[model samples]
Target: MFSCLKHKVGEVLLPGDEFSFQPEDTISLTDTVKPEKVICGPGLRRSGDRLLVSKSGVLRTKQPNMFWVDSQQKRYVPAKGETVIGIVTVKSGDVFKVDCGGSEQASLSYLAFEGATKRNRPNVQVGDLVFSQFVIANKDMEPELVCVDSSGRANGMGVFGGGGLLFRVSLGLIRRLLAPQSPLRAELQQLFPHELVIGMNGRLWVKASSVQQTLIIANLLESCENMTAEQRRQLFRRAAQGAL
Candidate 1:
């Protein structure tokens, strides 16, 4: 049965829910008879042309047929190339062990920083917040972090907090914030002149002009994890008016 979707958009889906493809509705190309494509995102799996929901959450879709479940989760699973906010937990001879809310502590190399070398190493200490990207991550191996990009540039991937506030949000919201052309960013930008470090690991660092403003920003964002887009817009508008 490759022609039936169990749940519509915005419906909360449970694990084991199955969706099938509808050939007539999905295939409209007259030039060639191509089978309808179903792109299964996170929380979904494909087994023999059957779409299986693997998480309990609302199902969402984007333009051009991308589907994913919007699950509220706090735990983080390390993935390569995902930038995250990490706390330095241990400093080894050559690497720093960082707690990034994952199954295991991630490792950051001492030489990962820009302009760092044997003669001049970055002065990193335990308990400091580091905004790093995963360079090596796998299910079977320990995760490794780096502060620089492919060109050896730090690119805002280094020490994260300097007297700022660090907080946690659901991993799904973090992904929503990092999404390209996200409306949340636009709304937040209009609220305050602040700096935000969004980590894939559910940690966020925010800095505003003053302590009160910073707290307001932090609380506002944390509250957005469960709000709809319209709700967030209304809250942001009211908060901005109140702040100013």
Candidate 2:
């Protein structure tokens, strides 16, 4: 089953692409046999005993049997455990309605933040940006966001401060930026020092030493979404020379 699916990794697959699980190889009764399992991520679904592709994108896999499709999508469908950048749209009694670039606004409770309590709520206001993770996301229910992890620590999730510029990019670009040993991130580090916050939902916040430098980073990121590797290298070289 894994062999049938692993062969298509990194290939562009369209909707309706399906892979059937192959029959297990026969072994002696005395031999130890472990059950195999595959986890399907975004853009892939399981139907009966086959793995089905639900979107158009490149197939990608992670270690220990996890697979997903890397696709360029503007609309975000909330999935549990994915971190996202959200704007507080409405603040009610004890919850804030946040727009996470998803189909609907996700609810964020005041107690979701670290050290928050009934008398001590996190200072969140309307129009503020928040870096949070989805604790409850499903098609049948309203999504919920949290600023703390299971151990009740912030873990880098919280409200954002001023001075950074937030912008949008393709979901595929976000994935690449967050990938291990990302070439784009490495090249950018060589040019200048900057701070970047990437969200799985395509929202990015970037800040540099100056406003001009910040804009330069933002423009380069937006333009490189569809560029080839060589093209991006040449562009980066020109930017480095201009900065000197």
TM-score of each: 0.85, 0.91
Residue range with the least summed lDDT across 10 consecutive positions in model 1: 1-10
List runs of model 2 lying over 4 Å from the truth.
Answer: 24-35
Cand. 2 TM to true fold: 0.91
Alpha-carbon lDDT of model 2: 0.92
Tens digits of lDDT, candidate 1, 46-95: 88756889999988887666788889888898988899999999989999
Off by over 4 Å in 1: 1-9, 20-37, 62-65
Model 2, 1-244: lDDT tens per residue?
A: 6887799999999999999988767776997887779999888999999989999989989998999888888878899999999999999999999999999999999999999999997999899999999999999999999999999999999998589899999988998899999999999999889988898899999999999999999999999999999999999999999852
lDDT of 1 at 181: 92
| Clash tally, candidates in order | 4, 0
Which candidate achieves the best TM-score against the true structure?
Answer: 2
